[model samples]
Target: MTQNLQYFLIPFMDWRIMLLLWGGVFAGIWVGAIPGLSGTMAVSLLISFTFSWEINDALAVMCGTFVGAVYGGAITAILLNIPGAPAAIATGMEGYPLAQKGEAGKAIGLCTTVSLFAGFVGVAALAAAAPIIARFALKFSPRDFFLLAVMGILLIGSIGGGDPIKGIMSGTVGILISMIGMDPSTGELRYTFGSLNLMAGISFVTAMIGLFGVSEALTQFRTSGAKSPKQNLTKVIPDWPTFKKYLPLAVRSSLLGVFIGALPGTGGDVAALLAYDQAKRTTRNPETPFGHGAYEGLVAPETANKGAIGGAFIPMLTLGIPGDAITAIIIGALFIHGLRPGPMLMIETPHLFWMIVSMLIIANVALFVLGLLSVRPFAKIIEIPKSIIMPIIIILSVIGTYAIQNSVVDVFYMTGFGVLGYFMRLYGYATGPMVLGLILGPMLDSNYRRTMQIAEDRLFPFVSGFFTSPLSFFLTASIVFMLFSQTKLYRKWRGIE
Candidate 1:
C-alpha cells in the first residue's frame, strides 16, 4: 500500500508531466467544443508523435485530453445548440433553452460541478471495482448488445419533439440511412448505389455537425437582426445547496456512466443518452420540463459522460480490452511503449496503474478549475449576433467536416444534411431523435447480424437464446420494460413527466 501511494504521487512530483497534462486539457476543451473535432480523433493524432516520448509523459497528455474533451463538449451544446459530440446531444435539449433564457452561465456552472463529481465517481469505481466491472462487461454478447440498441430506440420518444410520430419518422429515416454502406459480415453493399463516396458509409460526426450545427445556423437566419441573449455570467459555480439538490441524480447517472463505459464498444455517447432518458423517466415534477430548460436534463448527461471517462479506463488498464474507440487507440500506445497491457499488467508494473489513476484525478481537478474560469467567455458566445456567428458556424462545420477524412465529399454530405435538418426543423421535426438513430443504428445492425450468425441463421435458436442466456434475458426484459414505460398507464402510475 505504501509503495502504491508512492507510485500515485509520482505524476505530481514531475513538473513537466503536470504542465503537459494541463496544456493537453486546455487544448482538449477547445477541440471538443468544436463540432467535428473529437477526443478520439485528437488522441489518435497524439499517438503518432508520442511514440518516442516517455510513457508517463505521453499518457499524462492523453489522460488530460480525455477528461477535458468530454467536459468541453457541453460548452457548445449549451451556448449554440451545437453539441461538440454526440454525448452532449441531451445537454443541448435543456442547455440551449437555458441559454436562450440567458442562464447559460448557471447551466454550465451546474454542469461543471456535476461533471467533476461524476469524474470522481468514475475514478473511485475504477480504483475499487474495475475487475468486477470488467468481468460483468464480459458477459455481454452480441445478442445483448442488440437488445441494448433496441432499448436505445425507445429513447426516440424521450428526445422527440412534441410530436412523437414525427420523432419516430425522423429516427426511422436515420436508421435507414445508417444501412447505406456494406453489410457488416458480408462484402455486399446495400445502398451505396455504385457511388465511391458512399462506400465508406456516412460518418455520424459529420451528420451530427450538419444536423445540429449547420442547421442551427440556417434557422437562426430567420431572425438574423434580433439581438442575441445578453448572458448573465455571475455565479459560475453552483452553490453547495444547488449541488446537494442534484446529488442523488448525479450519483445515479455517474454510476450508470461508469458501467456503460466499461462495456466494450460503448462510449460516453451511449452512456449520456441512456442517463438522460433514465432521468426523464424517473424525475417527478421537475422544475422545468424535460425538453425545455430542465436542470436535471443537464445534470444527468453531463455527469454520465464525465463518469464514462474513468469507466472507459477501467477495462483498458486492467483487462487489455478497450471500453471505447479512444482506449482502443491507447492500447496501441501501450504496445508502442513496450508494455503488455492485459490481465497481468498491474502485477508486472504496478506503478503504471497507480500513476494513471493519479493522473486522471489531477485531470478532473484541472477540468473543473479551467471550466469555471472559462464559463464567462464561453457564455458570452451566446451574446454574439446571429448574422455574424451563423456564417462562422457554417464555415467551421464545413472545415470540421472536411478535416475528418480530408474528403471533399464529406463537405457536400454535411451541407446536404444541414439543409435536410433545416427543413425538418421547419416542419416541427426535432433533429435529436434522428441523431440518436444515427448513433444507435449501426449498433443495432451489426450486433443483430452477429447474433444471427452465431445462431447459424436458425431463427428458433436465436429466439431461444434471449430466454436461455441470463444476460440476454435481462437486456430483453429491460427493453420490454422500456417499451411499457412509454404507455400512459405506466406514466400515470409512476407520476413521471
Candidate 2:
C-alpha cells in the first residue's frame, strides 16, 4: 500500500504538476464565486478544453477545481445571500444571516476550515476504502441502482426544509423534463416537438444553469435597489472555543458524507443538505440558532460537501461506475487515454488511481489557502449593483446553454426553463429536488425496465425480494416515515412532530 501510495503522491513531488494543480484551484475559486457560474460548468468546460492533454494532467487539474469550486460557492453564499452552486444552498441559510449580522468573515472562516478538514477525510476514505468498498458496491444489480436513484430523489423532500409538497412537485417536474429526449428502450422521440436539438433532450448542465444561475439573475432584478449587507471582516479566524464546539458536528457530517457519497447516484449537494439537517436535529441547545447565523449550520454543510469527494471515488475506481457527474466526466477522460476503470484497474492502472488520490490531497490544501484569501475580497460581490450583475448573468447563461451543443434551440429551452424556475421560486418551491430528479430519473427509468425484464418469470417474487434486502428495506422505511411525518395528521398525533 505504501509503495502504491508513493506512485500517487508523485504529482505532489513534481513542481510542474503542483503548479498546474494550484492554478486550477485559483481558477475554480474565481469562477465558482461568480453568480452565474458553478463547479460543474467549470469542469465540463475544462473537459472539452483539455481533450488533448495527458490523462493525469487533465485529472489533476479537475481535482483541484472540484475542491476549490465546492468551497468557493460558500463564499458567495455567505457574502451575497446567493449560492454559487446548489451545494451551497444550506450554506446560504446560515451564511446570509451571519452576513446580515456583520459576521460574514467569521462564517467564511469557519466554513473554510471545516471544508478543508472534510476534504482530508474524503481523500483519506478513498485512499483506504476504494479497493474494498468498490468490490462491495459492485454487488449491486439494476434493481439496486433503481432503488438508489429513488432514495436520492427522496432526499429532495427531506432537504426542502419546510415544504415537502413543493419539493415533491419540483422533483416530478424535473423527471418529466428529463424524459423529453429520445427513449432509451426504443428509438421513438417523446417530447422533441419536431426540433432536432430536443432529440437529445435538455442538457443537465443547461437545466442546472437555467434553474440556478438564470433564475437567480431574474430575482436579482427584484432586489436591484436593496442595500448590500454591512460587513466587518476584521475578525477572520474562528475563536478557539468556537472551533472546538463545531468539531463534533464537522466529524459527524463528514462520516455521513462518506456513506452518502459511497452510494451510487447520490452526490455532494444531497450529502451536505442531509448533514445540515442532522446537525440541526442533534443540537441539544441552540448556539446561535439553527437557521439564523449558526456556526454549526455552516460547518456541517461545508464539511459534508468536501468530504463527499473521497466517497464519490469509491464506486468509480472499484466498480467502473462513476459516482457523480464530475466522476462520470473523469471516466470519459480515462477512456480517452485507453484506460478502463474497474476491478482490473487495480492491477492494470494502480498507479493512476493512486495519483488521483494524491491529487485530491493537494487540491484540498490549495482550497484552504484560496478559501481564506477569498473571504475578505469576495464580501464585496454583493456591492455590485444588481442591474449590472443580472444582465451579465443572463448573457452568460445564454452563452453557456448555446455552447453545450452549438445549437440555438437550447437557448429557447433554457429561457423557458428559466421562467419555470422563476415561478417555482416565487411559489416557495425548493429547486434541490428538481436537480436531483434530473440526475437520477434516467438511472431509475433504465434500471427499473431492466430489473423487470430480468424478473419476467418471477414478477411478484422479484417485487417481494426487495423487502428482504436490508438496504432496500431500510431506505423504504426511511422514505415512508419521512413522508408520513410531513403530514398534518402525523404532526398532530405526535404533538408538534
Candidate 3:
C-alpha cells in the first residue's frame, strides 16, 4: 500500500510527467470545447499517435484528454446552447440560460471551481474505495446488470424533465436503433437493409453530434440576426458563501458520479443527469433558479461530469470492463502496450493504476488553472458568426466520424441519424435517453446472452441464485422496485410514488 501510494504521487514527484500531462489537458479542453469534437474522439485518435510511446506516457496523455474533455463540453453548453458532449446536455439546460442572461463568466467560474472540487472527490473516492466497490460489483450478475440498465433507462424522467413519456419513447427508439447492427445471438442481420455497411450498426458519436450539434445549428439558423449574447468577464471568481452552500451538493453529486461511473455500461452522462436530478430534489433554495441559470444546476452536472473521470476508472482497472466510451478507447491503448486491465492489473501493474490516479489529480488541477484563466476567451467563441461556426461543426463531425475507421459508410450513417435526431427533438423527445440506450444496449445484449448460456449449463445454480445469494436477492428486489416505481399504478398509489 505504501509503495502504491508512491505511484499515485508520482506525477507530483516527476515534473516532466506532470508537464506532459498538463499539456494534454490544455489540448483536450480546446478540442472538447469545439462543437462536434468529443473527448472520446480525441482520445481514440491519440491512441494511434501514442502507439510508439511508453505505456505510462500513453496513459498520461489519455487521462489528461479524458479529464479535460469532460469539463470542456460545458464551455459550449453555456455559451452556444450546444453540448460539446452528451454529458454536457444537462449543463446546457441550465448553463445556456445563464449565458443568455449575461452571466456566462460567473457560471463558468462556478462550474470550474466546483468541477475541480468534484474531480478531487471522485479521485479520493476511487483511491479509497475502488477495491471495495469492485468487490461489490463482482457480485452482480447479468440479471442485475439488465435491471440496472433498465433503471438507467428510467432515469429519462429527470433527464427529459418536460415529458417523461417522450423520454421513454426516445429511449425505446434508441434501443431499436441500437439493434440496427448484427444480431448478438445469431450473428444474423436484424435492421440492416442489405447494405454491407449497415451490418455494423449506427455510430453513437455521429448520432450525438447530429442530435446535439448539427440539429442545434439548424435550429439556430431559423432565427435571423441571432447576436451572440454579450459575455462579460468582470466577475469570474466564485463567491465563498455561494460555494459553501453548494459544497455538500457538489460532494454528493461527485460521489454519485463516481458510483454510476464505476458501473459498466453507465457513463458520465447518466451520472451528470442523475446528479442534477438529485441536486434539484435536495435544494433548499436554488439560486438563479432551477433550470435557468441556477448555480446548483451548473455545479451538479459539472461536478458529476468531471468526477466521473475517476469513477469511470474503477471498473476499467478492476474488471477490465470500460465504464464509458473514453475508457473503452483507453482499454485499447492498454492492450496495445501489452498491459491488461483487470484484477490482475492490480496485482501486476499496481504502479500503473496509481500512475493513472496521479495523472487524474494533475489533470484536474491543470483543468482548474486553464479553465479559470481561459474562461473569458472561451466565452468569446460564442461571438463567432453561426454561419461560419455551424459549417465548421458539420465538417468536423464528418471528419471525426470518418476518422473512427476511415469508412465512408459512417458519414452516411451520421447524416441519417442527424435527420432522425432532428425529428426526435421536434417531437419533444430527450436525446439523453437515446444516448444512454445506444451505449448500454450492446452491453446488456451480450451479457444477458452469456448469462443465459451459462444458466442453461447449470440451471439449478442459476435458479437458486435468487434465493441463495443475498446480493442476487437485493439486486432482484431493486429491479422490481425500480419497475414498480416507474408505473402509473405505483405513482397513484403513493401519490407521486
Per-model TM-score versus the true fold: 0.98, 0.85, 0.86
When summed lDDT is taken over every stretch of 10 residues in candidate 2, the lowest stretch is 153-162
lDDT of 3 at 412: 79
Best by TM-score: 1
Q: Clashing pairs in model 1?
A: none
Report lDDT per candidate: 0.91, 0.77, 0.79
Q: In lDDT terms, which candidate is top?
A: 1
- What's the lDDT for residue 480 in model 3? 69
Q: How accurate is candidate 1 locally (lDDT)?
A: 0.91
Clashing residue pairs in candidate 3, if any?
A: none
- The TM-score between candidate 2 and the true structure equals 0.85
lDDT of 3: 0.79
Cα lDDT of model 3 by residue, 1-497, tens digit: 78987888887888778877898899888878765577888899899999999888888888988998888889988887767777887888888888888888988999889988999988887888888876776667776676566556656665665688888788777778888878968998988889777788887776776677667776677663677778788989888988898888888899888887887777788788777766655565454667667778888988888778888898888889887889999999999999887779989988988888888888999999999999988877776777777777678777766766788877877777677777777777767777767766776677666666767857776667666667667767865676666567865675542
Off by over 4 Å in 1: none
Residue 108 accuracy (lDDT) in model 3: 90
User: How well is each residue in 1-497 modelled by candidate 2, as lDDT tens digits?
Assistant: 78896897699788877987898899888766654466766788788888798887888888888778877777867775556666787788788888878788888888888878898898888988777766666667777777767766766655465577888888888888889879989878988899777788777656777777677777767778886667788878787887788888889999788767776776787788777766665565566866677787888888998888888888888878887777887788788778888778878888888888888888888888877887777766555677776787688678767766677777877787778888888989866567767767788888888878887847896787578777667666766766676566865675543
